[model samples]
Target: MKKPVIFLSLLASLIASQSCTNLEEQVLDESFSPSISYADIANGTLAPVYALLPSVFLHTNYFAIQEISTDEAILPYRGGTDWGDNGIYLALHQHTQTSTDPNLKNTWNFILQGISRSVSAINEFQGKTDATSQLYLAESRGMRAYYSMLTLDLFGVVFVKNSVGETSKVIRGAEAVEYIKSELLAVEPNLSTTVGPGRLNKAAAWGLLARLYLNAAVYRNVTAQTVTFSNDDLDKVIEYTDKIINSNQYQLSPDYFSIFNSDNHSNKEIVFAVDQRAELNGHNRLAYFSLSGDQFPLPAFPAANGTDGPAITSDFYRTWVNAYGSQDPSVDPRFYKQNLSIYSNPADSCVTAESFNINRGILRGQQYGLIRKNGVFLKCPDGKMKVGKLYNDTRNRPTTPVIFTEKVDFTVAGSDYSTGYRVEKYEFSKKSSSGRNLGDADIVILRLADVYLMRAEAKLRKSNDAASALADVNTVRASRKAATPPPALTSISLDLLYRERGFEFYWEMLRRTDMIRFGKYEDTWTEKTNTDRNKRIFPIPQTAIDGASNLPGYLVQNPSY
Candidate 1:
């Protein structure tokens, strides 16, 4: 799954460079020369789309909007002043985002940026003559379809652009879903079989189809109702998932922690990902966002401070409690309760120097890592590591020991650091003084374990079939576990499947989709008590509607905006 050398060269070329995301794409046809071959230009067509992935899938982008809106994660303003971006996180958790919420606008703009880039790529490689060129064109369409699917899923609308700078048809509901599905299937045959990570390939297309099929009913329903899963839809889910599983193109990671490591480009389980390298322009916010200021993962490196806030809700943490009943997180492969070790390396250039086994999954209890004393990490007298205590960084108790907790009140007045259990799914950058604010590891857009979980859900929904679903669930559980094996269940249900997904894919940007599909989104959780059904899909950004010169009346806001 290493990055292609041509793709690396594509990143360095001026042809791949992009103007502002909000701006129009300029035609670069005349700039190509005899020295820069046609293949390079064709590959260069894909660079903008690849570059836009990080903006859409990063921790603070779609990942936060999707996960924080549900119970999987939250980023409350620390001590009331720090993260209080006009109460975006609180409003998100409460399902109260308006058309003016900056978070929604940011997410919308970034996804549109991706769509615009994909369109530009499609227009640039329209008359390619080589297999490589055709593959680039196919990848462009596939990437376009992928971005459109996200747009449809989140906003319930898709902008149909036949070519660059063309007026888009405002497609909504089932029409949009069909458009995205058709686009993906059309390019499925042309995608490269050997496309590496960060690039969309046939396997990724299959997974996307399965996801679309899984949610086809919801997309069609528009209005909230009990979703009836058709046998055909279930078959498509099972079929597409099996295609990825049987192709042997990818497999579940033996160590779940390795999947999120800073140097995880080699993991075979990653079907498609955002190629994020510190030197190649990546951010470390995924790891740095949740970590407390005192709990430094890399003692020698102080690149960017970890702004602690993203943590699991009590309801989300209670899922494990209901399943394991105080069982140690080590017992479950998906849950890494403690972040104990680091991967230390000083000699490697263009990579973070500090490295250790920083744990993955949900974190609870007293936080322990390198403690910053004065300017350096403080050690212990008994030779054991010193556990760090977080403080209410925005309030009167900046130095007090603010222990982490699972119970959180979204409407409470004071900001307590001990509101919820923190998550460390992404590896932190080990650079002591790296200038870049981005993480070194590529953010995983889709992985094999999640696909397996989808197959399991499809089986359960098809006919309450448990045995087949159990095998798939246990398959992932076993692959991610230590020496001790997870107990195989003799039965499976929707509740079990939901909890299993929570264990498997927490904070990877699937929680909102899972919660909706399982019919648990409307139920009260943590600080969210909104029962309005319209809150399921976000309102189309008002800015977008105002900016839509072509589709003025067509770009209507979603209901109850």
Candidate 2:
């Protein structure tokens, strides 16, 4: 294998100096020696490309638009003070975001950087004839396609560039869909099946193709009131999903929460995920972001606490309530996981020598966790750790108990610290005991359950195979082996399927796309009443548009942003 030593050295130096924003330009301009064959460039050469994923998918970046912008999540101005961020979150939830929103801008930069790095890698490996070089080149193209899919999904445009310095063709609508599909199809054969979910593999490519085909209608026409689903496209979706299902490389995990646990990198359920192992720069914001500030999960480090970020919206919660009816959602394993057994009885205090795990899933009502006093964890009478009811001591409502309410108002007066129900889906990494930085849990992007659901949806849409679709849906529903699992549905409709997706994948950053595909994106939910079809895709960052201004119509912002 040929090593691109010069490329690696420059990348490291650029990253160290915080001049990574010009990574694409630097890599393109600096010529690599032809004697340094692509064969020597081992798999580690692709690390820089994959490294861009963590920041792009960070809870506060792309996750915000994918979730918070829809009814699934909301980050209100906590206690009329925190998370205000000049109304960026508020505007996102309200569908009033502009080109200058920091979240959108940062997300754009991160994703574009991924695309650039992938392009550079592809260029480096181009024309290599060796088997190893071909395999790596295929993986690079696959990654480029994956990032392009995200770009098209979010900003409604795909920048198709063959090389770093060459002008990118801004593509959207059907053109964008076809380009991505071609890229994935072109690389699918060379993708290694033995690779892990963290890396792009054959199975991951199949999953991405299935997803692209399943949402082909939406990608083609973002604002259509009744987007037509082509039977051929649906069949393609089914074909690809069936390929993955038949591969037998993955299975639905019996423990739903286990799929999102800190040590879930080896879990079979995950077909594709952002690898957030301890060695990588991963963020614990997904776990601690929605938790109450005073409720610290890790007793070993009292300073590592929550920021009281986004919470599950009441409108989204109503979906679960409406489905279960009278039965609490907590009964379903997917809805909530009670990990803190000692805190079952809030009044009972326990002494622990080590750190304890907190409860996971959608948290509602009064909260309880390890209490801290004077910058240290409060200890029990015997000099061990103590657990007690949590309060809003960190915010303005110091005296109020930390009881998460079902309803959260958009206004400052009504949006208190404890308003909306918070979600704690991902486990807080013990490695990140002191801050919100080092997370080890791999953020799931594609999984087997989702694959089954996509196939079920394809079956339903293609030929209205209700019996087969029902079986598929029931297969997922039965996979969650809770003490009393959610019973199988005898019948399934498109609406029922959409609701099932919500129940299975809430807070996983699939809500906005699901809502849009199901024709529910424009429906008024919580504080968001804006039904403007143009808000379907966010505006292309003004900076990006200005950067290309000299090229004359090189980049156009999305409609009505």
Candidate 3:
């Protein structure tokens, strides 16, 4: 639903009044603003807080730092020109990021904005006795805690502020952990259990809590050589995840890809997500981001194409090859799904069809799509459609066939348009037939599979119950059935669990954190060689540091910026 214009104006004014460094800025005192009534406040105060989520998760913002920095994904300058934004992506992948990186700055700003907006919503809802107002008040607080969790995850610090104009106390380590946990616990009772996944509810709060406790050790020691996961914390992870699992509110989708389909808003597997319905200015970047520029999914809109973005790293691709030796990974349903059936016969291309979908999962080898001639799609003599091998014509390399090589290099010659395997996990939105803008798929933030995995990890780490952990892992694996379904694992280990997470959640933007938690972040992969532990947490953005310069110790840069 669209928010009131008056509320939007007030929010704009509040944001404009403060500098980027001050996340806890002075919100416009809505008590004096007569234009907004309790009805309007109840309807629109929380909209902006939720609205900031899409931008925060955009491909160029938080997704870049989360995925590109890990071995799971890489983004080199295509043709030594495209995506060369001052080597920001290269620096991120290689662990050479400084305080001034634009991607970091953008990610920091967007997250802080979410926190700022949440604070504003809380301030607007305080002391109102209406049932709706009280419900929103609890939700606002819950969202603030969630945003704080993200802040702590990325920058190793959480900003604490209760109301407008209040100074935000930066807390880290154990103190920050307790602060975030208390906020969620305080609001849990009042949160609705039946609200959709887009909004914070009782189950979402529990999911977030489980996630926090699962990674508490990492947050507790951002720079330590080895950190210990406490038994109590692991127990908490199990407890919370068990609550979600028993609630029966979610399940593992039999069709693994359906969980990410365009109509996934109603998918029971999703515990929490950013509702990117088209009416709310949703975008299709996630679907288009990792695809090749020459590959177009929609036949009606030839202009809607990929941007030749990031691709899977060879180090990551090897994980699948090593796991299932002597068998192609595509035998597992999650590894690949061939949707373009007409292309099965390479020589017989002519087919009468109006539209078709490209293959899903990890895409490699020569690509194919509709051929064009004289600025129009070429058709067979019978007026039927025709498909041919795709070329790098979109990147001015028409002579070069679009064959994705398994290996990639940082050098310009080695990082061409067709250097590495691409991923097409999220289905392209049919609503975005005109271009890559309007997307209806809700971006998944938390899901039931993750809940099970977390519980399994806790069981293994806390009690060394390998049998129970293996049960949980196999439960997820068996849910995804295909012509040749994935076999149940006869064993389980920390390393095996880590690889399973990669297979399940790849391109969902959880790689960097997973790598660090699995103690593999510092391992040499592809072009990255640095093994510095201090680089675990990104440096606090330079702009934020400068903005808080006058206030001594308000915002200290992470160690070894």
Candidate 4:
């Protein structure tokens, strides 16, 4: 996070300065401050573009569209209140989301705001004649391309902005893809390979290019019965992935969990990430989104709370059941989770406090963590550490303390608190000077592991190179030191590739696109059955359409809205 500390400090100073002056007078007019140069503003202008990432990446917004909508995750209303939120969660999973949905509208506007900021940064950088100005210009253009890619991915159309405050013309399908490709390629040489995690660079741009081509067929023709992956696109995936893999700039992290730790800014695994800091308003959704309220870690921390939202689907979890039956992640080396225990038995742990330390994968069976009892932690029977019932905290109504269990049937009925296995992929940020909920962890957007997986998939899809694909997949598996390592598969198939992606990149914002490309998004799974083929892309947010009223026909809604 400190690699670009100068730019970060400048941006912070500008934000702090805005608080001292009247809001109305801070406009980009001739009345601009005589003390500060426009170059100074241009240098820090990318801050707004960076600011929009957290909102887009948060679990309830863009993440909701990417993951929750697929079979990987779901957030059901506990006791008809905790997460009902007008049935947006249910609608997303069920593929019945309307354009007016708050999440959809908010996410759409947030990405547009990023586009707006990118345009502003470019204009400001234009006025400055310096080496630093060119760097800023390239980074700004890269950011614009990234945001535009997201807009095009989620909603088929992207707004075309020639300059600031101009009416953006909506470009969809093939046209949008071409624009994004051209923009990324244009900025690639100018982008600094130095200073990353917080800023986009050459490697990140290459990763983005790889992603675009990998999904180009789907982006160009979503309505095709089976989207065709051309050899050129597949080669591009391999070409760009090799650039990162052979560049020697990045490598897979030794500790898989450390890649998501609060101190992950230095992790080599990350190609591009949101440098969320404890000092700033960072997101903690990945840390506690699925955790029960009573299962607090380091409860001594003040005012700590977990929303108890999303949990992985049973079908997703069942992917682990291989030819050898249910794989115990303990020995599975790389592709496994720590074993979860239910009680504070001396047999499991000589000291009860030791039982609370659970594994870092799909959490199932009885859960154990710090439990409050009469202002102190209560120990279990003959057990050393504290234990108590996990109350269903919907409406703050403490329902009967129930032991956590796997309810194979997900989409729990109203008030049926126990169901799907909770996901704990991101290392929880318990120890931080700044707020834990606003965590310190840098959320990784692209990584080396993903690069490897993408290569494997591209190889499989393009040339039926099963042996090479299997080797790539196994390389990732071998990297992790699981207590019980699942043996690497001897053969590879499209189905295995799809499951491997779920195993490697489940909670990350890539599931929905993966499901569609794999031809599984339309299949029935758990609570989701009404999957109309056309629902692959969400309806363009109604707010986006209304906001573009000034442009008339330019912002036509995508197909069915």
Q: What lDDT does the true structure give each of the candidates?
A: 0.73, 0.83, 0.84, 0.72
lDDT of 2 by residue, 518-559 (tens): 998899988889999888889987766665655566577788
What is the TM-score (0 to 1) of candidate 2? Answer: 0.92
Model 3 segments more than 4 A misplaced: 1-40, 347-355, 373-375, 381-385
lDDT of 1 by residue, 1-561 (tens): 632222112222322233222323434464568777776666567777877677676566687778989977777777665678888888898899888876677667777767777887888777967677788888988888888888888988887876754556778877887898899999999987787687899999999999999998888775567877778888999999999999998978877878988888778999988888776667546776776554556645633445776888778887787887667655776677444433233221121223334456676665545455445544556444444444434234556664677666654543455667777787766642452255678788789988998899899888877888999988887785544556766677888888888887887888898888888888898778898878889988766666553433757889989
TM-scores for candidates 1 onward, in order? 0.88, 0.92, 0.93, 0.87
lDDT of 4 by residue, 1-561 (tens): 322122112222333232221112123333349876766566457666677787677777888889889888877776555788888888888888898787776676667767877887887777666878888888898999999898888888776775764546667888888999999999899888887978999999999999999999988877677889989999999999999999999977667777777789888889999877766667656777776665565434423445667877767766665534744643443343553343434244323443344357666666555555444555657857653445544325455553445453333452355556777777666554432456778888899989998999899999999999999888887776524334688888989888888777878888999998899989987688975777888887664555445545655776656
User: Lowest summed lDDT over 10 consecutive residues: which window, candidate 2?
Assistant: 20-29
* Higher-scoring candidate on lDDT, 2 or 3: 3
lDDT of 4 at 548: 47
Instruction: Give the CA lDDT, 0 to 100, for residue 125 in model 1.
Output: 78
Question: What TM-score quantifies how close candidate 3 is to the native fold?
Answer: 0.93
Pick by TM-score: 3 or 4, better one: 3
Off by over 4 Å in 4: 1-42, 127-129, 323-326, 333-359, 374-402, 408-415, 431-436, 482-485
Alpha carbon lDDT of residue 225, candidate 3? 85
Q: Write the per-residue lDDT of candidate 3 for residues 364-456, one digit (tens) a residue.
A: 999887765444666789887777888877776778888888877688766888889999999888876455876888999999999999999
Q: Model 1: runs farther than 4 Å from truth?
A: 1-30, 337-357, 379-399, 411-414, 431-436, 481-483, 549-551
**Candidate 4 minimal-lDDT segment of 10 residues:** 16-25
Which candidate has the highest lDDT of all?
Answer: 3
